[model samples]
Target: MIELLIEQRRRNLGGGMSVGRVLPFAKRRMVGPFIFFDHIGPLDLVAGIDRSVDVRPHPHIGLSTVTYLFSGEIMHRDSLGYAQAIRPQEVNWMTAGSGITHSERLEKARAIGDHLHGIQAWVALPTADEESAPSFTHYEGNDLPSWSDGGVHGQLIAGSAYGLTASARTHSPLFYVHLELEARATAEIPSAFSERAVYVAKGEVEIGGERLVAGQMAVLKQGASSVSATQPSTVMVLGGEPVGERFLYWNFVSSSQDRLRQASADWKAGRMKLPDADDQEFIPLPEGDPAKPS
Candidate 1:
């Protein structure tokens, strides 16, 4: 059964490039442990597109940033001194235990241009691990588990799903899978988790007989459910046990409001270090009180 339907809202990530932000909705804040989700472009980038479109160094804390691409490439540089280029099906998982600053640049696409599309989700760390040491890991595309059943093909991106466990390290119980369905193909949504949602990333899908187009997400109530592709479609299925209440502001996620304030002040005062390789410029803290949950 469906609980709530969420539509993507446009958010400018600076430099004229905008993304469809789907999570952290006003009515529905968190799904499982996922605190933030952004659907990047399926658009074709023109050669010579402004370098300003690259995401500059930004800070994050108390969460793990997962970046998975469907196409194109993004060079990721983090304060941990890790610089890696992620391509289709690859995953770049960075845990900002206490704090970390990083930047995503369109290094390859900037010259010849390319179709850049991906999903970036932030999983809030459990309260016990919130202050742990920061770390980063990169998983190759072929390293993950993949399965095919009839017309439904799926890859377990992280956590566990369909009895397949991904290689990407996770801090909690969750499931994140990428599914590609042919027209008329069907796949069942796992009922093992306490919370679950299906996001239509491309084409259309029918869940509980409701048609969901691209940019639409259906948060399902506790029960068994499945998705049928109205056409050739791409979808992401994710959810898990709830991590209880979390406070979010800007890029910080924490259970304590005071910690969020401290992070804001740390970044503003240059106490947090920037990416060693890409530290010439960084996104300044927004001009406002840190009381607001962004």
Candidate 2:
């Protein structure tokens, strides 16, 4: 049985850039620990006209940011005094436990015109780790687990799946996997986790005879057998134990609204620390609470 079907909302993120938002839907705020999900460009950027995937310094609290890319590169800098460049198949995991600031842009060497494609997700921290010390970690593609069998290629980006686990650590139980399938292939999806969903990334997919194209998400009901692809396709599979109810405002997420308000004030008053290199820029706090599904 299928629980829900969601068509991603194409959102313009300024500078003529846009992304497909796939999570925090009104019908279902989250699938497991995932609170926010965005699929960035597979778009073409001109050499002279477009220069970078520039994201200025921003603050986050009570959550972790996960960045996974399929192509291109990004240079990441954080208030924690961390700097690194992430390329295709790499992982950037940043936990904004108590609080943290960071920025992401095109890598200096790869800043020239090119194609960009990736997924960025936000996972809310459990109540216990909301105020824990912030941290950052990077993993190379070869460092994570991957497998090939029966025409299905899969990678465990974080957490455990298919009797294997990735090195990426999280405060809660969750799973994020990327799967690429050959034509006319069927991929088995075990019910190893409490919650799960399938996202069609590059081609056509079907479960229980329901078709899902690129940018569509199918929240599967219990007893999911497998997913079949009509043609060669790329899919992202994610879900896990719920993180419980949490409040959200702009870039901040917390179990207590008071914490969110405090973070908003601290960001506005310049009390929060920022990246040393890009501290000059900060995203202004939004007017009124724009909490989704309101």
Candidate 3:
């Protein structure tokens, strides 16, 4: 059974580019350890798109950012001094333990006028690992476990499921799987974890007799079982044990509001290091009450 259905909100990230923001919903702040999720464009990158479309360097703490693409490419540069280009089916996992700064650019897509589509999610760190050292890792598609059955294709993005484990390192119990279902095909939603949800990235799917179209997510209740595609569909199945309540503001996530405050002050005062390669410019803190958890 479905506990809640999340409608994706279209948020314009400036420069005529918009993304479907699905997580951090008001009614449900966190699903498992997954705190934030954004569905990037399946958009045509027109020639002469503004440079403003590129995401500038920004800071984060108390979480790990997971970037996976279905098409096109993203150039990632982070404070850890790693500059990597991620393509479809690949993973870019970056942990901003204590704190880290990074930027995402579409230089290649913009130059060639390509189609770009992807997902980016932020996983809240365990309270104990909130202040650990920051790190980055890029995993090739072959690095993950993939399988096909009953007209469904699956790849484990992180954590463990389907008796297969992903190479991407994880701090806590969780599962993030990418699935593609053929028309009228069905797939089982792993129920071993305490929290589970299925996101329809493309096409339509039915769960417990309920239909979900593209851009919608069904947060499943306990014992919720499987999903069947009404048509050929692409889905993202994710969730895990809760990592406890986390406070988030801007790009920061932490268990302590005091920690969030200090992070804000540090970035504002230039106490945190920006990405070595993309250090010429940085995003400033938004104007607001320091006590607010946005």
Pairwise lDDT winner, candidates 2 and 3? 3
Sorted by TM-score (best first), the order is 1, 3, 2
Q: What are the per-residue Cα lDDT tens digits for candidate 2 across 1-294?
A: 579999999998666678999888889888888999888877777665433337778899999999998887778999999998878788999999999999887654244676778899999999999999999999975667999998999998998889888998888888899999898888887587778899887899888898889999889887756898899999999988898998878889898888888898899999999898774867777788533412
| Tens-place lDDT digits, model 1, residues 8-89 | 9999988978999999999999999998889998878878888789999999999999999889899999999999998988
User: Which runs of model 2 end up more than 4 angstroms from their true locations?
Assistant: 49-53, 108-110, 290-294
Q: RMSD for all candidates, in order, please.
A: 0.9, 1.9, 1.0
Mind sharing the TM-score for model 1? Answer: 0.98
**Model with the higher lDDT, candidate 1 or 3:** 3
Better of 1 and 2 by TM-score: 1
Report clash pairs, candidate 3: none
Q: What ranking of all candidate models by lDDT puts the best one first?
A: 3, 1, 2
lDDT of 3: 0.92
List per-prediction Cα lDDT, in the order shown: 0.92, 0.85, 0.92
lDDT of model 3 at residue 26?
A: 93
Q: Enumerate residue pairs that collide in model 2.
A: 41-116
